[model samples]
Target: MGHDEPPQHQVVANDLRRRITNGEWEVGAKLPSRARLATEYRVGANVLQKAQERLIIEGLLEGRAGSGTYVAAPRERRRMVRARHREQRGGSPFRGDMAEIGRSGTWEAHSEARTPAPDGIALRLGIDTGELCVRTEYEFLADNQPAQLSVSWEPMSITGETPIVLPEMGPLAGLGVVERMRSIGMEVTTCVEVPRPSRASQAQANLLGIGLGDPVLVIERTYYTGEGRAVETADITVPDARWEVAYEFGIDA
Candidate 1:
């Protein structure tokens, strides 16, 4: 083909994609080698290789180290219901977050003591920029698969000397944000979230089993009490490929 013409690799890609979508090759079945396909398609080996790479990036194919490429198994898409946390309904923040979606979920968390609040965290928690705080990191799973991740911070001045000082330890272990605060005489009355799309970092990509730079959803949430004090703030992350966030609103007439 002339340089001015459309790339021969793309034509080969289209044909292969058609074969896959048409069920000519089932998932988990190895694909033909580049040289064989190149000869059969009357294209250069390099062109065939490029065509296969395209499918891999598109998530239609997978490449095993030292093993051949094969059709990728489909990934299941789950829903994350984003709504106002109603304490009256009762449960931990994560439990409530996943309630409307009807998915069975569990979480693993690590708590650190007396950590200095980062600049942005302090601003969100309404404390001085270098204030001491209790920090907790969580990895939430649904049906035994990684569903979401969150890192939460609470001002030490507020939680210090209280049983709920460490979010995932002491008396109120595993309690959601509101209940944990309420146990210490602080009533959480409001929750505000700012959500945006972000790219997956190397660590996040590894944990979420996705390629680096893949899109993920980021939500920044802050909880408040009846007296207007910021009690807790958290950064929540959800992988885009496996989850979708849905927002529901009720209009009052």
Candidate 2:
């Protein structure tokens, strides 16, 4: 192969991508069968399969398990903004986040007994490995459609025996992290966020309705107390096919 030449699969994917983007194939329209497409492109079925897989990862195509491949509908790109000042006002971040994206949101959260923190989670929350911590899993929905998923951890050393320990089983139930910590006299003052793009894990893909290996945005966030102690940390997942994560600040009053 010439150094300047692109891979055959990539070349096929580009041609298909162009057709989809150009509206040659309207959204939700089925593409030619693999055998037919391979013959049309003068490539083997294996090569064409690889090409369609690229489009699938790019959100330009979707393959239904038994229904063959089709052009994907244009997804609504919901903006996910992280403006510190807005959150300082104190409320459910999930609710506000969805509203900003022009959708009504609800979530189902399940909290579990305090358990030994995993090494990665402990490091993020600034706790020792095997230390007791409260874990909560959340599935956030916009208009009843799954939009995001998260898993959060808070060290039991800080919340143990407190009314806020369960996170969703007290007077402070459903309150945001900053507010919940405040109710227990821990003043949460700063939050740090690190964002990265990664292939969707099977669990995430199942919940978000995207194929495995599709792009998704993962946010690792930690809230700190006034004394710089990490109070809580969470891994937030949003399917990139359906949301556009953005950082907003400096709003004029």
Best-performing candidate as measured by lDDT: 2
Model 1, residue pairs in steric clash: 92-176
Off by over 4 Å in 1: 1-25, 28-73, 85-87
lDDT by residue for model 2 (180-251), tens: 998889998888999999999888887887778889889999999878899999999989878888887686
Ten-residue stretch with the least lDDT total in model 2: 82-91
lDDT of each: 0.84, 0.87
Please write out the lDDT profile of model 1 over residues 1-253, one tens digit for every residue.
7878778888888899999999999999999887899999998989998888777765788888888889998777877777663455666756766666776678999888789998999989889988998899889988666788889998989889888888777777887888888888899898888999999998887676665798999999899998889999999999998999887665779
How high a TM-score does candidate 2 get? Answer: 0.72
Model 2 pairs whose backbones collide: none
